[model samples]
Target: MSSNTFKQAAEAARSKTSAMNKQSSEAVSAVKNDFLHTPVMRAALPFINGGISGMVATIVIQPIDMIKVRLQLAGEGGTTGPRPSPLSVTKDIIAQGKALDLYTGLSAGLLRQAVYTTARLGFFDTFLKGLSARAKAKGRDVTFVERASAGLAAGGIAAFIGNPADLALIRMQSDGLKPVAERKNYKSVIDALSSIVKSEGVTALWSGATPTVARAMALNVGQLAFFSEAKAQLKAHTQWSPLSQTLTASAIAGFFASFLSLPFDFVKTRLQKQHRGPDGKLPYRSMTDCFIKVAKQEGLTRFYRGFGTYYMRIAPHAMVTLIVVDYLGWLTQ
Candidate 1:
């Protein structure tokens, strides 16, 4: 009786384990097949890829962005003198505290990228895909003009949606450049948002919306258009590897992006930080006034204040983002 009972129990357990394993394997295979084959899965891939790549790029580049903002804000002291170079700004920042101080507004930067970059890149890809499909149906291919238009529209919309985060970012970055007593001392992205809302009201969050949106449109047009065309050109005319192609395209994209958007970016930062004087008058009435005054008073070069640092930040981020996006898409598909 004991031998028969023990043998039967062992046999039952083995059968149950084998059946469970088979079911699990089938489920895994089904999931893998659907992810590889489904249209819906493919469609959502761009958004996921773009969002993740953007956040990753933002993390890598936030310090340079913070330094760029500080360089621009450090100009307040330079009005009667020559503007400080990026190296001087970096040294000054390091002198103020630890090297990591250069990443003071990192949280805001991440939030901005999560909202702005994600939306802009995702929407551009989505729009591009739609246009490509339609064009293909007509026995045509998507044009560069079409790509630029998609990028511009996507960027403008995303910038508007991300304005609050962008304003918070500028404030947080510039706040550290202020006198200790005058600093708002934002604790984090949420703290900055809440403080701005409490002190200034909802509309204040969008104070520089015009310039912000303009900068984004310019940036998208430069980055997206240049990258696409440059990559295609490299592919068609040369035998560059994928890595070489991405790096070259990204550098070209970054150059144009920094050049076209720096002016608007400068204005946007100033406008976002502008406040009503004790006399109830704001420094600049609008974007045009800000641009004019900056050019006249600070000189035209103020618009390109930190071009080297900006290029460093923009180029690496663009390359990382594009490469990651491509890699993720291939892995997923």
Candidate 2:
């Protein structure tokens, strides 16, 4: 072929490639637009984004969470038991098995996030919008009480819905505490759920549900409500950038969340970790009973025993989740 013929062929190929690229770009744009513009997707976006964010945060913060749990369970049953530090707990966990042992029950944790975070965030966002609209109609701003109410309602609902997964997570995390011969040795979240159901019935999956719900409500009020309020206040009062505001707000929220929720979380873990004794009786009769017994036997201060570790876990998790959710919302918008 002559030089001109070869040039003409190359030019034609370039044009065709450009055309295909343009078509592909257009298709992607169309799909994105459809998703963003659709009513169903718009409504579901908060839940989806919240779940993804929560899972990502959980993956990063799992080690700290494991340490916190171990720390909480260290002095079980009495005040004169072992007082384990976070470093000690980490070393103990690693010594028992491998580093991955620290990530026990990660499957159940992810599933809990899928249900709990999704529902809590989605409902909070939905309720916030309604509250904002109502306040606007009244020619006023949304009060902190309104924000807290939204968080409480969302957390209670989500915690109840996610109790089974939460229970499985607690059971799996605490399994290693048992004697090797007595361990259930759950292979996965499914295994844990199935084993619990088979051995104790479906309702067993919701063990410690009362404390779980209370913890969720406390956490959400501390986290969601405080985060929103702090961010708003920062935005109004400070010259900080949006990122700075988010970070500060999240840090504040995390501290409050850890502080407010740790007692209930402690009780929840204790309850979920217990099974029927050889005498066919559980340790604590109910949430109230657990609280009373713990205060009487373990001392009131025991509830806050792992505050530092809990803050480390809760703060980082809250920061990551909120930051990711904010980023996702921006991207979707």
Candidate 3:
């Protein structure tokens, strides 16, 4: 009687286990089919979503970005004249004009994000997918370095293409530190580009292309590679919610990006705002020359003069943009 009961119980347990496995496999297959059918995963959706997310983030961070640029352009030696802090810059900008003047280059910023962020993010995703597929086919996993390279390449290309908008942004922000009479008073990003082309030639639009592209490459590294790694690590090791994980990863990525790119940004701003004289001669001969002049006159610290303001701008912008992107993706699913 005991042996018969034991055999019956074992047989029932095996059958139950087999049925559960079958049900689990079916559920997984259903989810996979649904994912494949979703339009959000289409090739071009990343670019569209990336642009929307970037524009939204840019709008929210525009003020901070203005303050950062002002701080970057303030003072000669990073401490020579009356030193300008973020609060002082904000006060000056608001005191001089409408409080909204703090968003002087909103149009250009949005346009730049639309062009730069869309391409950088979209290209990276496309390259990543291709690499991942190949790796999977070959029975291997994609490496972090490969992903970082993709981010770098995408950013460089996008930044170069979007240099006109970027140059306009710097020019608009540069006016904040100038007397009203001397200011260009660009009406919009379009006006700024037209004026530059008319007065300075179309090539002037890409005045700071070198440093801008470099900054973009570094930013991509931070925003994509570092953020991806951080997020993956957070998910694997922590019990944090999706929002927390994104915020934490974005913060870390933003800091890295800002730190790596600020020096290049300072140079980009300086170069973009410079104009040739009557003789078609410019103050700075090249990126290296500008770096030397600023370093000699403003000191080495000038390159990082706006660290706090930049971090303030970059971190929240990165976090919000990524969060929005993730939210949109999740909603689609």
Candidate 4:
């Protein structure tokens, strides 16, 4: 061929290659859109599942959570009486108030789970989709790490937003000594929130923010990373439907995440309880002090107080939350 003809041929080949590359990129984009879209269509399932599961799990584990909080809040050997083990705490409640005590704060716990879990799951998915879209617009692929980072951010933000409800839930669960008159004063969630803010000040609502943030960060990391990985692995090995896969993966993720963050949770619960000294300020003063004091008085094992309950609550909570969220997204689509 002539030199001009050869140059034209080379240019044609280059143009064809560019067109093929564009097509491949579009195909990848289409696949990602499908993946994201599937979840959105079934979004209602996740909300329902998460709400129900979280409420049930919280009720089942509230007593152990109560014990955990009590152990955490107890001053250095300043208990009302002998300390009870996790198992004994339940027995004590049963002996004293029957099943009612164990289910203390059931309403508060249900409200919290309903709000926080829905927000966390909903916002996390929304944020992830936005981030993925942004990445795609920049001609980039969204990595698992990116997804996890988004999840962490979403969790932290959600925790901060829902911190007030969380405080109320904790207070209701652990307020064993407060009189019936005082307890009955706050009728609704808003009433309880208003009462706390008025009596304890707005800052009281965020008493355990440090540990709450830490827990949220850890939880998101575990859920996003582990849940994603588990789903992928399950899909590879089993022919389960999307719902089944989502539920199984979420349960595994929730269990491990809860286990990992149990210590921080223990600390957070301890610090938030009414530990005021004579000056009407918190006795522990800070998260560090709370940790140090608990360690000194109750030993390191105490830091993991109610760990079994933590696992039991978290595993099902996470599983249900994920499954419900995923299913909801599916239904919507």
lDDT (Cα atoms) of all candidates against the true structure: 0.87, 0.94, 0.87, 0.71
**Worst-scoring 10-residue span by lDDT in model 1:** 73-82
Per-prediction count of colliding residue pairs? 0, 0, 0, 21
RMSD of each: 3.6, 2.2, 9.6, 14.2
248 Cα displacement, candidate 3 (Å): 1.0
For candidate 2, which ten residues in a row score worst on lDDT?
74-83
Q: What is the TM-score (0 to 1) of candidate 1? A: 0.89
Model 2 lDDT at residue 220: 97
Summarize candidate 2's per-residue lDDT along 128-212 as a digit string, tens digits: 9999999999999999999999999999999999999999998889888888999999999999999999999998988899999
Which of the two candidates, 2 or 3, achieves a greater TM-score against the reference? 2
How would you encode candidate 1's per-residue C-alpha lDDT over 63-118 as one tens digit per residue?
Answer: 88888887776655235766678788878888988898888888888888888888
Query: Which is better, 1 or 4, measured by lDDT?
Result: 1
lDDT of 3 at 104: 91
- The TM-score leader among the candidates is 2
| Pairs with backbone N, CA or C atoms under 3 Å apart (clashes), candidate 3 | none
Candidate 1: misplaced stretches above 4 Å? 1-26, 33-41, 77-79
Compared with the true structure, the alpha-carbon lDDT of candidate 3 equals 0.87
Q: Please report the candidate that would top lDDT against the real structure.
A: 2
